[model samples]
Target: METTDLSTLPVPLHPGLPMLGNTLAFLRNPLGTLHTLQRQHERLVHLRIGGRHQYLVLRPEDVKHVIQENHRNYGRSPAFEILKIFLGNGLLTSDGDFWRRQRRLAQPAFHRQRLAALTTTMIAETANWIVELKQQRSKQPVNMSQAFMDVTMRIVCKTLFGSDTTGKLDGLSAALDDLNYLANKKMLSPLRFPYSWPTPDNVRSKRARTQVDTFIYGVIEQRRQRDEDKDDLLGMLLSAEDEDTGEKMSDQQLRDECVTIFSAGHETTAVSMAWTIYLLSQHPDVLMRLQAESRTVLGDAVTPSPDLFRSLTYTLQVVQESLRLYPPAWIMSRRAHNPDSIGPYTIPAGDTALISPYLLHRDPTNWPNPDRFDPDRFVPGGPKDQLHSYAYLPFGGGPRLCIGNQFALMEMQILLAMLVRSFELKATPNQRIIPKPLITLRPNQSIWIGLS
Candidate 1:
């Protein structure tokens, strides 16, 4: 790919307008655009968008090269600048040695032991939410999507932050929405305006950032002044010292990580559960089987042990399948620091690679009848065992893979199991459901449903 043949051969470009490239289509319906490209091009499709060299990597091995094999040579894309407004330089946006040190310091918080404790919190909080869900029952339609978002936020705040956002939910939700809009616009728009330009969008984004900063910084200050054993994520993050320097995270770093974790932890799991619920409602056979598994394995249980949670194979399969179809964090981008060979194409220095889980997961080559909702593919020794390592990446791959993978999965399993077991939720008739691709993929507007 990168040998002398590279100079003679050129990367194929996805067609676009003069100077604008695929910005319009990519921004209009990024998932749809990429999915269409996945069908037309081979693995790596090149595009020049507003003077930016963008490569849409479609195959697993090529994605592996960017995010794993030669990962050190690739850093997070500059498009993350928008997220930096609200997320700061947290794990999701940061790169290089700084990211490595931060990763090392934060790794312990998600260890198996810590995750087990978090599981208890997840189970308890989910149980409480289930009771509340039941209590709120009425003839009025319930938007389970928002309900999932609210419940997961509470669980994440309580389990990770050692506090909850009971009254702050509405404020936080609005702030998150505004920030999401700003981030989305920043990523897709042709003009790259400085966030400090004081335009309407900039002003709104700044206000949103201020609200988020105030909330997370307040949480960090509260934890710092506390004397209790701070093993909870927020506590551990506060007390964590770099093994190399014996220095703890700065207030900014802590706030960034807190916001990153909270934004990711609650939102990803909530959307995954929402999609899972929507899928289950559409597939009665899968729903019946999932409910049966829940009743058989977790009958009236407040908290199942890790081993017990793992025993629900079908339930776990359902969650995995749902994630495959509707990954929370749908797209990841990396910029090459040097010339690199990925399959047949050479990634030029400074070229940005877009790896989409949404695209890869739906490839018929990897998944037969890809769009069909089938959980059996994920059975322990089933079809999933044979897929390429990078083919099914709901939580992504490589060292920078999501640190909260286990926390997110466990929360999704527990909540989905409990929600489906003693309850019946049906998607409202004649409703349009589309995956709204923002910071994470979620249902457009509210997913109207009847919960009984």
Candidate 2:
């Protein structure tokens, strides 16, 4: 690697409105703004948002540098600091030794073998969802977004806590809705007041947080009182001990991890599945291919088994391409801990680096005809195989990559196989669906699909 003199190179800055700079434009359409920046400015572009200088990394090499090569020089940016309010010191928010410890303890639960055991749970839940859809018996438009959310939430709860949270799902959903809204608002606002201040939004946020905490703590307390050791993520967490200190996670630690899993685990997968279904509804050719593959691989089987899922290669490819277009974790930020070199420019310490997978996945340089809904891009000898390593990061890259990537992938594959095999989904005519870049890349409105 070559070092560049910080003073010698000129960083191109995106011009924006006076005073506010790109703040309003960014808040209005973050993904669009990012794509424009990548297209117009190329590799690395500088911007001033709310008087703060930030760098948008557009090239794969720079992204690799920021996230993998010199990751030690970067830490979770201020965006995640706001997330810490809801996530606490969980793996998503915590850094350094604490994060490492938590990751180690929680890692076993997401292992391939462990996740395989949960496949039956995932398939059973999807089967039940299929039954409910069939009972509708009409071409009634259903909100696939919410439908996916409901099913994924149940799957996560059962797999993680080893209990059915069907009754309490509404409370958890409402609390998460409030928290995500507040978190997004804070992230976009240039001047955010302290969370301690009892403003209306803050009060609502606090109440929502309390609701989430109460439910999580209640579960933890009940499990602690039980004498049996069950086989679930929560069970593993409660029984896990630090090899160095022989200590288990405290209640607060357990709460933070559980909340993180609930928020991060369920919502992202649900959104991915919803977007995939919507995309398939719009593209009949792709849907036909997916269904054909599903039927051939999962013939006469009530549900997808581990071996059956492996054989559904085309179905898996469709899921991959869907993720390419609508990655759940769209934008991630990292703050430079010390002055570091990213390509030609030397990023100053404390400057924020924004990496947008949503933009990168659509970059014409990486994916030709970037916006086209094509699953062949992920097939063998496909366009994806020709791209840079970090070009398509739905679950991100590096050691900090999403631990549950396998779990989420398997869950989505199962759902896609089961649902597509069971139902004929048609997009509601004249309906407009927009992608809203919140904490997750969610549909701005309900995705209305008429099921046969």
Candidate 3:
């Protein structure tokens, strides 16, 4: 039951243009706008966005309040309905007992030991990308964003579905383009025909959805009938049975989980890797340290193994710093199920409160010289060790911390080590590139890179 009480909304609403509120400014510069408003008022600032109530919570303690300490009173905001367009009722979008059960069933596949075994698969796919990049054999700039997206999508497909999506990449790419466009547009504009209506946008989304469904469902059906090796995440999901009732996931549930894993596992990792490499291009000193560490750890080896991953501390730090500066999962919105108090502020029930990793990670109070790209902040007992736990959650926090967090970090480490050790990468000179904040933070323009 959502509380409609307005008494708890004590903060003054941030000013915006008439009728539209701050939506236009937000559309132009989301990060700066929110941070500026919060600074002008209290740490918790209210704003009317798309005709809805949203309180921007900037305090680390307030973040701890919303996502950790008093989490039960909060739930996935209505904003998640957009994600469900692709993810369905999987762990990313589901709530309560359903999400709990899905998490339990899907948890075993992501165990450290199980994921360690997939390191080989991750390296192989990355090596394949290297081959593809080399075959192009040109020093001219290529779109590194799309390149990372392709390689990461291939890696996730192989590890999660037990096969590489090389052949289906073109089709999958086109389908995702359509879906992403619709989802982004709807999120920004907020007025569109019901998905069921025969609007042109709805039809395009449906067609794309069907194309992806065919591929995922076909893979699931084929695997179900075949008696060959079942050693991947999909296999685990299929075989997993609830301890309470011994019930296995239905085909529908499997499809939903597979899509969830694919979307979550693929695009976010792609964006992280792209940003990591691009940031390295700009910071040669940091890149030099990373290259030194990569060469030392990966001497005479074309690919890194799980054993060497621990020794590449600087490489890991570079990745960590990249996430802090340009976190792919930058902001998340949660709705209150009941009236709640966040630090000194009150959150009325049913109102949306946004806890942004981007905001918290950039707060000077939480991080000294917050905007600077300083990997040492993450160093052991070096600044990060002193901040509150919720102050730096690139993968979120609390019970809903991303299950694939380790998986993504390990994947990025292997690829970064391989790339730096093997090739010299230069960001295309003289082009403006920025982070475009969407469901994930992505390069606003095509980030071009050259390889020697």
Candidate 4:
């Protein structure tokens, strides 16, 4: 691997007000500003976010170097601190020894073998939703985004915590929505308009966090009081012991892990399903292919198991392409733990490092016709692995990559195959596909789709 001098880095500062470091400007037009910067400077550019300079890594090689090779030099940024209120020290936010231990314990839960049992659950959830939607087709254009979110939420909740509690989930969903919106505002707002200063959003966020905490704590207590082996991740976590130290996770620790899994597992997969249907609605030929694959791979069966789901290569490829174009975790950041040179710039300790898969996936130099929804780009002999390591970071990379990647993929594949085979998705005329930047990138409005 080659390293470049820090002096040679293209550190172009976008114009901004005196005290704020282009926070408002970036918020207003993040993708546009990044695109403009890419046009004038090298792929790697400097962004003065807040008062500190953060490297906006756009080049594929630079992304790989930071996220994969030198991952230890970086950990998640303080911006993620907002998530701590509910997520606790789960795999998504934990660092150092805590992260390592939790990762080790939780890794098996997402294993191909362990996840195999959950395939029936995933397929059944999808089938139930699809059938319900098919019956209601004449009512009005269905919001596929919300519908999928509901389905994924049910699946994850049932699989993680057993039977569903609609009231608890309703409260949790509302609280999460409030927390995510306010957290984003806090990240982008200047001190003059500090988010903590009695703003409506801040107040709502506090309340929401409380709701989430209450629901999670309730679940934790129920599991502990029962004290019986349930054969779920929570049970395994409770049963797991360290070889050196005989220990189990504290109640708080259990609560955190459960909330983290609930939040992380549901939103991302739901967004992916929504976008896949949106894209499929646009490309009839590809939809036809997906439908054919679904029928061949899984006949009229509603609950095709996870093993059968993973074997559907074409269906998986379509989902992969949708992820490439509209990755739910659109922007990821890391704070430098050690001073390191990335590409032509030296990042000092405590500095933020950014990676936008949205930009990387659309870089024309690496992906030809990058903006086009071409599922064939992911087909066999399409240079999937041959590309730069970081060029395709839909689920992130390196050791800290998403623990549930395999689980999520299996669920999505099964759900998608079941969907396309049963009915065709027709996009509502004049419906807009606005990108709503939540804790994830979601379709802003109801994604209206007619199922036949």
Candidate 5:
């Protein structure tokens, strides 16, 4: 469908070497370089990442048109082919009817009722994290990134799979690390390093995938072998039948969905929590306000029970603001399935489109004092719905919007409330907080924070 026609859509060939189109330039400082391109070329800029034509979408209307109005024509980008190695045909990587069916099967598993039952699981996991911090109170400062990773890993495994799989937490963590490394490296690599090669990195990734698959399949097999009923997501999935076909997900289908959920479910939330803690450390007043809000809301109560944090407006606002600043899924991509006109440019069927939350979050036009840390931007008096639908996208928009949004939000809110209520975040005097862009935008180094 034609939206807007621009006979002269400026496609500047930014100074680059033969065969490579703005690859090195874009890689150096992704955000800065994209901003420069946006300024020069306006909302629709055609870039070549290693000779690959990539359209950088900046305007809110363009984003809405692509992601909301005509979403089906776009699927995950070819750049994410590396992710397919690990995730298989999971929700994040899959497209068309496969994505639709998987989403349908998995949606009910994370329904409010099911997630509400897992609130106790979140509390216990966060408490475990606090205990670890309390033990190291004087010994050494805690690494908030690693700590959050561990907490979310446990919570996701326990709540989604079952409590018994908690023993496999270390293996899952290692697998996730390996997957992240391979996926990010492949993004910038020209040769598109083959995972089948006998290289150490390839071998490690393959081995990590095997371990993760083993764990996932083990859970699937055990569920099948068991005659009795269990109530976790896995159990629910096995029981859930398609309304149209009245069919259950095959073993492989179930495993793919599990891996997708396990990967997207935990890692993104972990990154969000890590950034929230790190940012809070940088802004102590925000931290103090959060602590006061949490304590006042939960008075004398220590743990993060559902009743204690369900309506904690301030705490939720802080989490929302954190997501706005450092959205975990930094860049989302989609390739047109058909020739589509977006604003001034005509995108052919094979061309890929990208919506960068990184740029959207820091857009000067949308956010006032865009670089500052102000949770109040989301407070009551703040500009409500002023930002366009796709302007402030952290969880994304449209039919493919993260199905786990509520579950992730609930997990973050509960964990943030529980941790802030118990400890004051103290950042290291000269610690570095570099954003490592991978499957998610996470801290490159450990975020050192001391407890009160």
Candidate 6:
């Protein structure tokens, strides 16, 4: 690939309707639009969104350049600015030194060993869900989407706040749903009005944000009153000190981190697990193999420990493949702070760069039969092993990679193992499964599965 002087040559542009640019097309079908661009432009594609210049980077090397190798030249995109209203400059939305500091402080909470110890909590919560699911098996079709959200939310609450406050947090799933809907709406709108306006969507978003803030703040107050440190994430955050300044996080900072973790931790895992189950339900052979692996490794054990869960290799592969097809964080955007050179194109400063795992994972050149659901691609020495490191980034890459990647993986493994062994999941007939690319890739319609 020959390098191109962007100053002299014009980059390939994806033409769109006047004024609206690609905004309407993008809103109508985000994943499809990106896929089309990737196929047409091959490497770098420029898009004009409401007069704003956006670059869609499709190649792995380009993705690596922006996210890892040359990450310093890039920062979180303005697209994520809308999320600051809810995330409040937390790890997800914060950039520069503050992000680094927060990442370091919160890293200990999600360490592998700490996550290993949380296996029991995962099993216990999953067991409770199994019981509830069993009771409702004979009722109307199960909304596995909402059900997984409930399970993952409970697990996150327990793991983050400890078991004492787990059940105390209700309406979290609904509140988060509202937030996701509002955030995505604002992100895709060509003419986004200030959030301060009294629009109906803004009103709903504020109410939803207030509900979440009220609950999290209440938790912080209760923990503060205790005057004792516990072993949970909240406890760690309360006692965590900045390595440089030796200062602790304030109430608002703590609240922000908690809310960020609360939203990111649960929403992604739930969607991933829900989509994984849905995929398994569609592929009976894969489901059979997964069940066999579960039974063989678990051997009638009611609950799975970390070691036993690790032995379910095929189950983990299914999770990986599901994420490839339906990555929770489907699209990521970054802003170039300085002029940067990718393989053959120069990205000018101030240009927005968009990277989508949804498109990258499905690229025909990197993945053969990309749309097929095949867990074997993730096995040792499998096809995915041959691909570039950045080519398979469901959790993203570089310095800002998802902090809870390990935690999310372990939680999904435990839930899938327990649920698959305990019940038979079948998708409701006549329901079309559409991946809605919002903050996370979710089912556009309700995913109804009959649990037998």
lDDT of 3 by residue, 11-50 (tens): 6678899998988888889988867875686578888887
Task: Write down the RMSD of candidate 2 (Cα, Å).
Answer: 2.3
Tens digits of per-residue lDDT, candidate 2, 266-325, equal: 889989998999999999989998888888888867766667888888988999999999
Predicted model with the maximum lDDT: 2
Off by over 4 Å in 2: 1-8
**lDDT per model, in order?**
0.84, 0.86, 0.83, 0.77, 0.80, 0.85
Tens digits of lDDT, candidate 4, 1-452: 99866655555555667777766677787777666766666656667877777878878888888878888888879877766653677788888788878777677767777777777777777788877877777847788878887888888877787656765777677676666666666665665344457777767776887888888778778887988776666776777766567777788777778778877778788888998889999999999999888898777766665566656889989989999988888888899998777655677788888888888888887888888988888888786656887888888888888888887888788778887888777878998787776568788776888887
Candidate 2 local accuracy as lDDT? Answer: 0.86
In terms of TM-score, which candidate is stronger, 3 or 5? 3
Angstrom error of the Cα, residue 130, model 4: value is 2.2
lDDT of 6 by residue, 1-452 (tens): 99855554446788899887888888777888887887788788889875678888888988998899989889988877889986788889999988888888888878888787777888888988898898878857899888988898889898888845545556766887789888878877767888889999989999999988888888889889988687778888888888888988889889889888888888888888889988988999999999988878877666656688888889899999999999988888899998777765677889988899999999999999999999999998989999999999999999989998888888898899898888877877888898987788988876888888
- N/CA/C clash count, model 6: 0
TM-score of each: 0.95, 0.96, 0.95, 0.92, 0.94, 0.95
Could you give the candidate ranking by lDDT, starting with the highest? Answer: 2, 6, 1, 3, 5, 4
lDDT of 4: 0.77
Better of 3 and 4 by TM-score: 3
Candidate 4 displacement at residue 219 in angstroms:
2.0
lDDT of 1 by residue, 385-411 (tens): 998999999998999889989888888
Q: Tens digit of lDDT per residue, candidate 5, span 1-452?
A: 87644744544445566777678787777767867866676677777886677787888889999998999888888876778887788777888887788788788888899888888788777888878878778846787778888888888888777746666789778897788777778776777656777887788888888988888888788778884467777788888888889888998888877887778777888889888888998898898889898888877554655777777888888898889888988888888888788655677778888788878888888888877888888876676366786888888888888888888998899888888888877888888788877668878887888887
lDDT of candidate 2 at residue 116, scale 0 to 100: 81
